[model samples]
Target: MKKTLLTLCSVLCCAVLFAQVPATEKQALLDLYVDTQGDQWINTWDLNEAVADWHGVTVENDHVVSISLLFNNLNGKLPASLGNLSKLRILELSFNKLNGEIPAQLGQLSNLEVLALNANGLSGTIPETLGALSKLKQLHMSSNKLTGTVPASLGNLTAVEVFNVFDNDLKGSLPAELASNNNLRELMIAENDFVNTEIFSVVLLSNSGSGLNLKSPSLSPQAKTIIAIESPEDGN
Candidate 1:
């Protein structure tokens, strides 16, 4: 009886220790699983299993760093608790059926580099808090039902190289500060309702082929002349 009791105590102690590393992170994953219909997942995670063994989850030194579950058939609104993954670097949930507004709390991920939540049914405005991800390199949330103007705060992503938010219902003028990001390579904001666009530097679009198409901006005669001079020639 004493031997059995000792074994049970050891098991409980190990479970407690496992739960201690970033309690919020562990609970956040559990909440995400429950909210996103884990039972319907193509390769469902066994909640009883260790964190490292959970499918699509990448843990390093007991810290969740990446969650790449692209096209895994996730079909629900993302839980806000997901922002608690402080060490998260890449969060790719594209090609799913996720809907609803993106959690503003995602700004808390100071270490995030790539955030690809494109090709979903998500709607609502891009959260201003996303600008806080100073380390962010790529931000792709295209082919969605999102509306509202592109937040000017996004210009703060100085390290961003690819920023694609195409085929949406966004309106308003493009922020001029976006050109300040010298690292920017591709900026696809087509098929929207933009009435004005801040003329970007020639260097920014030197390699930007036919994909860059903005509506005729409401500008002065001088501005129009400048645009003609800087515009890349057709079929160039």
Candidate 2:
């Protein structure tokens, strides 16, 4: 009876194996979701299991376009080699313990659309090279330890949508060039020390000018635990 049960179990296992997706297909799925994160914070990405099963991240497909990993508890600095993903269209790395400056190499991704790095422990000034991305749409870098003025060259982004940098230690005035952008929907600069951002037409201008600080005013849902975490209050 024991031998018969073992044989039955073996046959069932084999059947399940044949029904599993091909190795290449599995790799593709993992690669697509390798950096997926959601609205929740505090959960860091530990890809040890994925790495162990597949051995490494594969961003080789030139057709591959988007990669989002926001709100994942991925601590530590980003791997510089990621700059090699030239065909990448979207990249989001917000709300983590990632420190250090934004890699200038990221500017090389000419097709990049969205880039968010908010609510982290990051520092250093924004990279000027980011201005080079022609296809960039949304750019979020708020609620971190980032300092220095907003990148003046960011004015070059004509296709940008959301450009938020609130609740940080950033200083200096908003560059007048940003006002010229025609495609931007939101321009958030609240809870910091922004001087002005009277540029462009913003659908949501939540807190553009003063009264911004590291521990400044409490905009609803700004703390992350709230359900509907929308834009900050517009001081416009």
Candidate 3:
């Protein structure tokens, strides 16, 4: 009788601890799992288990808040349903084999802070809608096949600190509005084909002491001079 009572108490405790997220949030996660080929992931989730027990998932107040699956061999494209996780803050899926253009719906994640999707096979332009992430801080999309110019709308990310887009095929002038963002710290926009590079000297100069990696051959001599003046250690 004591053994049965103890088992029941344990079950009740586990139930409370693994309280599920809302149906929509749960479904969104499920969509990601399916779209990303979860079966092939380095750390796969067991759907039969509680949402809180899922690998790389963090839940709070019955809402999915964060998902960090970096270098997890996540194959396939990111599901658009991910935007449904309204309370989600961090979405890190770097160094994966995932392909396809980033879904614009991700911009709907208003509460998002860190958006790391680097070192993948992703292509296409960075979505203009991403500028809507008012709370965003770290935006990493480096080492991919992304093209097109950096969206001017991204300058709206006043809370952004580290904006990295290195090792892509992006061109055009760096958005002037980015210069106005006082919170920006690290700006890595190298290994691309951006024109009118001299205009971004201010942006590059500001992040000189930070982890600024602007060594593109396309940079004008004037920009190089600014880099040398601001970050003498780089010896541009």
Which candidate achieves the best lDDT against the true structure? Answer: 3
Give the C-alpha lDDT of model 3: 0.80
Q: After superposition, how far is residue 177 of candidate 2 from its true place, in Å?
A: 1.9
Worst 10 residues of 2 by lDDT: 227-236
Can you list the residue pairs that collide in candidate 3? none
lDDT (10s digit) by residue, model 3, range 2-119: 9999999999998788788999899998998898889998899999999989999998888899998988898888888888999999998888998999999999999999898888
Clashing pairs in 2: 43-73, 44-73, 179-199, 179-200, 191-212, 191-213, 192-212, 206-234, 207-234, 207-235
State the lDDT at 155 in candidate 3.
82
> Please, what is the TM-score per model?
0.78, 0.63, 0.82
RMSD of each: 7.4, 10.4, 5.8
| Candidate 3 weakest lDDT stretch, 10 residues | 227-236
The digit string of per-residue lDDT tens for model 2 on 1-236 reads: 99999999999887654444345434443433443231223443244433223222223332335555554565566554456666667666665667776777778888888777777777888888888988888788877888888888888888887788867778877667776666755666666675553333342433433322333333444232212126422211
lDDT of 1 by residue, 1-236 (tens): 99999999999888766754488998988887887888898878998888878899988877999988887888889889889999999888888889999999898899999888878899999999998999998887878998998888887999887777766889987666776668876666666777655455431221233434555454334332221212111210
For model 1, what is the alpha-carbon lDDT of residue 197? 51
Quote the positional error of residue 67 for candidate 3 in Å: 0.3
Tell me the spans in candidate 3 whose CA falls farther than 4 Å from its real position.
Answer: 1-15, 201-236
Better of 1 and 3 by lDDT: 3
